[model samples]
Target: MKTVYIGTYPPRRCGIGTFTQNLLQAMSGKDDSPKSKKGFFVVAMNDFDQEYDYPEEVGFTIRQECQRDYQEAAEYINLSGADCCILEHEFGIFGGRNGVYILSLLHRLKIPLIVTLHTVLKTPSYEQKEILQRICRTANRVVVMSHHAVEFLEDIYDVPKEKIAYIEHGVPDYKFLQQEAKKEFKLDKRKVLLTFGFVSRNKGIETAIKALPEVVKKHPEVLYVVLGKTHPHVLHYVGEEYRNYLIQLVSELHLENNVVFIDKFASQPELFKYLYAADIYLTPYLNEAQITSGTLSYAVGVGCPVVSTPYWHAVELLADDRGILFDFSNHAQLADILIDLLDHPEKRLRLSRNAYEYGREITWPKIGAKYNNLVKEVTAEQLKIPRKKSIPFDIKILPPFSLAHVKRLTDHTGIIQHTKFGIPNLKEGYCLDDNARALIMALMAYKETKSQKALEFCPVYLSFIYYMQNDDGTFHNFLNFDRTFVEEQGSEDSFGRAIWALGYMLDNAPNDSYSQIGKYMLDKSVPVFDNLRSVRSIANVILGISYYLKNNMGDDVMIERLRKLTAFLVEEYRQNSHADWKWYEILFAYDNGLLPLAMLHAADILKDEEVRRIAFESMQFLSDITLKEGYLSIIGNEKWYHREDTRSDFAQQPVDAMCMVLMFYQAYKMTDNIDYLKKLFASFMWFLGENDLRLSLYNYETEGCFDGLEREGISRNQGAESTLAYLISYLVVLEAHKNYYSKYWQQNQTEDLTSNE
Candidate 1:
């Protein structure tokens, strides 16, 4: 089975890149199985603004920080006919918080995936842990280099043990002549101690430099060679400060003659020759947190006598006298160990012998064979699990309808406005806008699935609306948990949303008691309609009046109220709109599609041709801006699209997606246009990861949705408004599938037959 490798690739100057290149080489020409020809290629990751002349084997290249590139790369991999994908996962190599942008690619992949983790921190940040856990969930098998990482995955990350495969870092399979390599480097007369790989402050090179002076005092011919360039990232930002400091330290210690710096990224042959030339390998890493050190692995694989700090990898690799370890930053201890090993030729030979014996098991050929078998196994297992039909309109991919998260957010009072993660953050108290949304969501949930829990909460949310309304027909937006209003009056937006909830109840209420209560609240709010100046407020009031008229079509007073609201919305569009901008406002802000959604509702109820025309035109305008990419890119709240300014691409709110879904569904319902139905599905998919960042905002684990899509990643906050928006969109999509999709197709079939006749 052919495999596509996703990671940084040569000649990118990244350790992960080198590892991937080596793995690809090892696995090449090894596929003899009949299932398919075993082969490998790469999907190289390019750092920001840095490009490479990649080889033909690199099927695709993904710019690290460009989010769309990841999705496109996944598409390329899927179409490449690769049976399985192996990803080299490192936190810093990919884009977004904790390298979350990789998730988009991983999620879209159709084949089995195996991820080899390069770093596994014991105490990961919130985003880091989330990203890793999500990665583990997506991968068929997770590979880690060290046993400590396997335990960390199980104990800390809660990954299933069965899903983890421990694979040691592979080393080059080549023989080296130490004496000849030493002579070639002109270090044959000296005792050579070497440290290689990208140099950075964290490597503790100064500790080794300080220890060298003491070692040189006893063995005057001792030489310490520092190899590899400064870490590219550190060099880019800090500009060789650490490297300069190390040079100065060597000079001040009067050990300049004993220390030499080789600042180049060595090829494998060159690195292996240097490894054999050294009597000892020094890894003075300052921390014990390193789960895997490729340089250290290479040193051991070459059978060099190793002197290193007790980093996690060193401790495990040197447990059985394979190498010696010293305390971190304790140069004196390192010095003593070095002097003893240099003096005792037999002891050094024994360490080398033990390391070589162990290294044989982890040579590149053996490690490559293990990975090849794993790929075959994962492929066979993947074939056993029935695949979902690859149809865009399949509703089978939708999560089962549930109100568990909504119930978690709601209380006896009402659904809480905000949550920290999935837990309700009562400190934020409650808001009328969210409660109004919660009421509509609950009604739709009950209407679609007849969920008893949804019907049970309808009264609870309606009660919140009742408690927030003032005697004067205005409503207080905020309320503390103490059940007291915190404001005298709410924004026009909140009041309009309250009307929307009440009107929706009048139309789709489960019983007469709810209808009476909704009618009572909506009738009292009608007097405040004339005062609604915000275009959003007028639009929302129109939707409420239209829904109300769905039940009481002959209510002339309500019809007049709807006409006045529609007129107000139309006048706003007439004043602000031009040949270029077909919107009801000067700029695209939050809930941008609401205006057209309201217009559609008014046009359907009024049966006015001009109103219907404008409604479809504005809906198309919104669709052009948001769905031009064939997926919803909600107008971001961060510096929204001004009349002539570029549109900000992040901080995409869920409410905008929900509004588009509603508006398009309404348009499809009126016109039976299949295009609108497709757009509606795409808008709903924004929650499921088809947006700019391509990260799903809906949290299936908690059944709650994240607040929005921000520049860094999905916002961690799962607030009521966002969750309600997702649930409402989900219900609407289901409604379209049930009431429109099959019928539309059947109607098309009938039209085809009629034309033939």
Candidate 2:
């Protein structure tokens, strides 16, 4: 389809210019056939007496402060045989008050129009509101990045909800590796804190500089890197006044050694590299109404943990532990958060992971696809073509399993609890929780690919389990940087997880040596199940026992232990199973699927029909609540689903989605019902943009899944647990699809032979 984009195209030093160029590049990349390539023409916006070495794609140039240029461009577009025109709208980019000059072009445009709004002010002036309203009325579709912008447009600007489409600000798909970039820049040892973009008072760089004194008190070796030159408009008018003020402040605070300024506009790769080198990214912008910040997007994209004032974009992107948000201009709170994260390296690592994982959906390819789809919809509507009712299932090709981030989190001893972005934070020390899950992930990878690399991790993880185990068979969860155990007997969940890992290793160990190690740990941990009181812990133990019985059948002691655990679970279910509430607990929280899944496994091993019935019934109840509207509507971790209270719809986790996939697969296996298989695919598709937000949780580039889905957006953190959950679910889904397709082929062959006979 032929399309024209009106914007400040690149060769111009503006965020909107970069966005327009990126969008065109992505669209062109997606279209492989050069002969039938979609015409992506650009009408560049320029300032008075300003000139750029425009590329061949530019069809026309409109002076920003010129009124007649807009009408001329519109007339040219009308005669150009373009199917649709997409205007990248920013008030300052166009001429006249509130950019009302764009109305002249909109009035004359004959083709379908889609206007992508870069900013939506919550409280717009009368003229500002009217101009936007006119644009909304004139355009076939209005695009916004944040949901808050959509709300503001609809409520405050009187724009209809149907007219607005929420597409996230585009971020480049960069790998989550920071240490190598740090080494390249000779910043391998320093704690690199960064804020990049055009220097402006609204950017609130002064606040970050103010916060640095407190931050440097704890982290004396901290380096605050301020990249990017002053904003072009700020440079043209103010002559670096704000930049001078910031430099003076750094000197006055005795932070000359800490602050380093690179006064130039960084290219995309350079920007990403700088972001990678950063331990924490800061965006202390003063404008709460600011809806989009490309710097923030890039920082989160490269997996930098952010500490920002809660602007509209930051508030949406940094929700759910993805980043820490301080109030606007609150340098003290910013300092406190920075110090706290620096002191507790584990939390910083977690924040970085969250940001990177969440950033996957907002990357250019995904955003471009969303834009393309919207354009198609607009064109189809204009041409009176019947569009498909359901979105086509575009199965994302999963990347080959890489131990890149996983190995980053792991040291010579064990996997650390967190990372600062993708760099391991050794100060957080080691944890059995991650090592246990990592063990299963490695084994699963080895089982599927039979790679020696996957097997190499097995011993490290197995040894970690051995390290955490006590003489009486209990395991410690946390280990400090000095290799000291923090707790005597770890939480019930940790012990149960260690057992689960051991059981998996025993069932699917690559060799006899691994199996022997697994068997010893399994035996040592089996007797500890009698002490587990938490339903999830007991449920986890039951799963481990089921795995054990799968390999070594007719073990009477293991059978009795399994039976006792099953009885306890059944009693719990009976007590809690009311008319509508059919769960083990009053609230449906994390790992809720494990309870029913454990029952399903127990029923198979024990051959108990009652237990099987309860398992199916309870699973059905859980599915009924979670699989609403044919999507995985997870019970929110923030405020879980209580018996009498409303179900919190967000903070839905990858673990929960992974658990549901397992439960559905088991249910389908036991019943041979195709309906269960359908649910399995749907739940699996939750990671692939089949969820409520229509955003993918899986990052194909990083091979990591986002931590959770929040009310505002997906959690950007690509932590160990969430990444493992996606890999596990992905492998299972791959197996199911393989088996399914294989069976169809065999059945079809039989039918052909029978028909010939």
Candidate 3:
């Protein structure tokens, strides 16, 4: 139990100040028990009476609040994590309004109050009892120091008896008492008599003094110390008549030595000394309402034999054994108990011992134990109560892309409508069947990772290639020459394409429809080239070089022929293209991908050192001149798309063109040259970095993302070829985390390089 004393200590005066001062000193006097709280905190009012500090030895902690800011205090209290509060209640000092601040504090704190009422009147005014009633209704328990207090509250304040407790004030320290104590107060140097506290008419000091004459006759040297000031309020309430009257009676008794009028105020320590010096302490109070005289309690608390009022408080505490309670109506008889106790030094010593033993129990340790239990109960209940997630919705893609952790709805699939995919220029009735395209994708899947299925697509077009073959080895022109079952047309141009494709697969394609077609191509293709090996044999040259690509045969026959074909291409047709479908196209386009890629590889492997240099120079030349202004353009000249209704730059650019560019990027990756890498990345940034629409290039139309960035409502080219092209570019950047991040991603600039923008 943490002790929180709710009183007016530092910043004010009145009953609360003095009461709290005494309380703090008593509570601070000893160490609290281990099972109990230790700190004695004071929550005081500040500003007008702030800046007061309590000694640490006194265990005082402070909480401050302004007069009108109790609401703020209440809210803070509600969450303060404290146990219980101790309130000092009084009608006058609270400034009325039924002490609503305390009520507010209790409701917000949700804790109990150990209320100590200063006054419990038998008949209170309307405003007085209203305040008391309000405080009583909110209190968990009430601490009344005397029986009269308990009775007055039960009847006048309407507080329930079960809520009331009687815990009397403890003894003041004897050290203070020893200072003011007198030896001759003892008769035969063995008797001492004292009366102390604020003097008032009803306190019966006059009766005590008058009775001292009879007391001294029995014990002649007995001394009565009337040591305390008259009440400050007595002048207004009843006048100085009582003070003058008591002074006159002291003289009339003619026992000046025995009835000493030491009527001056005393300090806290001095008051205790008078009580300790006395063998008998008397407070024969006449007023019925004086239930608790702190001075009276101090006397009995120090175990001095006491002759006090036969009143509600005296009967309740001094308890008929610790002290002698006498009838105030018979002052003469009340003197007899004091006279007897003074004569019996042994009896006085016994009473003093009882008070000291009991006073030690009320030491702070035991009192603090009472406070700790209350805190444990309140906080335990609070902890048991529960509190509600931060966002609450459905998820599509989960973190980590794992099935165990992810939640997915039931409709996702890989295949989609042909329109959704990227096949451009479809005639409504003449669209390529997915059967043809699916085979390509399936083969592409295998080619992507060499998983044994590119063979499937290789056969799919095998029959078409063979149907175009011709006799005399000149080959088909516009259509198939062997159209025995259909119309006649020839495409000898397609002959070289078909032969090159078939021959490449024949040597190393996984054993399946692909290799069989390779055998068929080789069986028919060599003769067409051997007879002429000119334009038609250009296909032979492609086929023969592929044999070199597939194996290190230690034979130069096919490789020498390929060199001758290259010579013929440069010497003859390389000067100009025949048409859109030109042999020169095949010349440049061969080794366009990794196989063309392997041309250099083959040269390296076979130690065809001259060929390796040629391959490197040619590839580099192609990438350089054709890569227009940081972008790869398929047309050797810019004029190719100039005459069209929609230009390559404006309309849907075919995906294959970008794919070819990525192929160059791949070549650059192989070369590791800064120039190639720089151009590649700059053109690629038209996608999302600091360039062109500064947007998604794959989704680029002539305008923006929609319709692949359309203009004039034209659908932009966002086809499969484009998608793959962008993906390839992304891979290039991703593969070089260092270069990509430092150069572009991190906005780092190099001295020799042109700015990326």
Candidate 4:
């Protein structure tokens, strides 16, 4: 397809200009068919007194301050036989207040138009808001880099959800060569912290400079590198005032030995080199409404551990231990975080790995394909042809296995309880609840990838489990920071959960030592299962017993215990389940799927067909309740569903979605029905924004999932349980895809042989 891009093109030192150039290059690389020889074209935007040596791809040009230039460019594009036009929109890049002059070109354009918004203001002035609304009304599709931007446009600008597409800001695929670059840059011993981009007042370089003195006090060889020259507009208006002020601040703080300035705009190669040489990247921008950040994207792409103020872009990118975030202009917090990271190279390296893995999805090549796909979809919509919605099914796009957040949440003793907005809350101490889940998740991850990192976590978590066990075979759920148990006997749920985790490790442990430890723990916990009162706790113990029975099948004691627990669960269902109520309880609560799932496991282990039928029936009933409108509508925790009360629909947890995936997969296996498999994937897609809010719970940049989905938006906190839930669900989907593809391949091969015969 012939596509044209309109934006500020290169030789102009603008972020949008570089973005348009990179996007066009990537798109052209993808358009390799012989029939499309010309590749993509660009209609470069220029200022009144500025001009670039235009490349061969430039089909036209528009003077930003000239209104008539826009109309002329549109007419030229119409006559140029291009199939569609992509407008790389930035307010200041276009002429007129809020860039309203671009409306003239958009109005006159005969071909289809796709507008990629570079800046989405959360709170806009009257003219800015009106211009954006008009653009949305005029364009076939609007592209934004962040989910936050999508929400702002839909909620504040009244843009239709269908018209907006969320595409991440593109970054170059830079290699990670820190040691080589550091040696080349003659900074072999220095810990380089860098902030690169045009030096505008809003860039917040002073904040980093202010924080550097304290950082330098800890590490004498610390270097704060401020790269890139003053912005062209800033230069034209103020003449290097911001740069000079930052320099003065560095001198005043007595940080001259620790601060260096590279006062020239770096080329792409030089930028990559500097990024590779740096230890940590910093972006302390002042604007909270700032929507897109190319510098931050580049830093992340190269895998530099980042320390950024919580701007809109930073908040989305630095989440979930991908990097460290401090309050805006809070230099003390910044210094503390920086020093802590520098003091601990292992933590810095972990953060870098997470950032790099996350950046793979947003590289220019991947982003180019997303843009191309959007263009095709918009083109089809413009021509009024029916087209299927694009569903992301590529397992490769899933985040890589990184234990950065997991490690961050854990101490030598155990994983901490709740985090205060992604930061580990040391005051809350450790919890048996999270540590149990952590051990299971770590074991599963190790089984799948055989990752040494995953294996390292096993001993720590196992030790925590052993430490929490009381003499009576009960467990303490909570412990203070001082390592003293806070409760005499933990809740039944905690005890049962610990049993479940132990059983899982017993069944899946890679080595004999782990197996033995797991067996010891399971043996201790089996006697207490009969005393559990909560239905959920009993259900959890049943699952544990089922795992134990898998290996030690002839153990009559364990088998009898499993049978008794199964009887109790069945009795609960008989009392609570009726014509309309198909659950074991009057109200559906957290981890509801585990109840039915345990029944399925027990039915299989005991060879009881009646119990098996009941398991399927109840699971199907729950499925019907959740899978509405072909998407997973998890019962919200804000106010759960009751027998006679309205079903609440906000604050849906990741645990719920995760439970459905496991349950549906099990059902698919038991019935050999494809419908269950379809449900499995559909429910998993809830994390990918195939739900009510249409916002993704998964953050590709951090390899972390947000805490939960809410009525208005998603929870920004990426805690342990949420991250583990997403990882578990992702692993299930990956395994299912592998098996399905392998089977399909074999079937095809067999069919070919039959056809040949």
Candidate topping TM-score: 1
Per-model TM-score on C-alpha atoms:
0.77, 0.54, 0.42, 0.54
- Which pairs clash in the backbone of model 1? none
Instruction: Report the lDDT tens digits of candidate 1 across residue range 1-757.
Output: 7889999988899999999988887777443233322356889999877989987778799988888898899899989899999999998899988798998788789999999999999998756777788789889999999999999999999999999999999998878899999999888998899999999999999999888877888898999999999998898899999999999998999997899999999998999999999999999999999999999888889899998999999999887989998899999999899999988989999999999888888888789889999999999998899767534366887888778888898999998999998899999899999999999999998888988899899889999999998898999999998888888999999999999888888889898999888888887888999898998888888889999999799899999989988988888889999999998888998888899999999999999887898899998888888888667888888896899999988889999989998998999889877778888899999998777766678886788899998878989889999999999999999999987757967989999999999
lDDT of 4 by residue, 226-336 (tens): 888888888888898888888888878999899999889788877999999999999988768778888998888878899888888889988878988888888888899
Q: What is the lDDT of residue 664 in candidate 2?
A: 87
Q: Whole-model lDDT, candidate 4?
A: 0.83
Name the regions of candidate 4 deviating beyond 4 angstroms.
1-140, 143-393
Residue range with the least summed lDDT across 10 consecutive positions in model 4: 30-39
Off by over 4 Å in 2: 1-396, 711-714
Per-residue lDDT for 452-570 in model 3, tens only? 43343444444444544554333443321222323243343344544554554555455566666556555666565544434433633454355434553554665565555555544
Off by over 4 Å in 3: 1-3, 10-18, 25-39, 43-83, 96-111, 147-156, 173-190, 235-242, 261-268, 346-350, 353-360, 363-365, 371-757
Clashes of each: 0, 7, 24, 0
Q: Number of clashing pairs, model 4?
A: 0
Task: Supply the TM-score for candidate 2.
Answer: 0.54
RMSD of each: 6.5, 21.6, 34.0, 19.8
How many clashes would you count in candidate 2? Answer: 7
Best by lDDT: 1
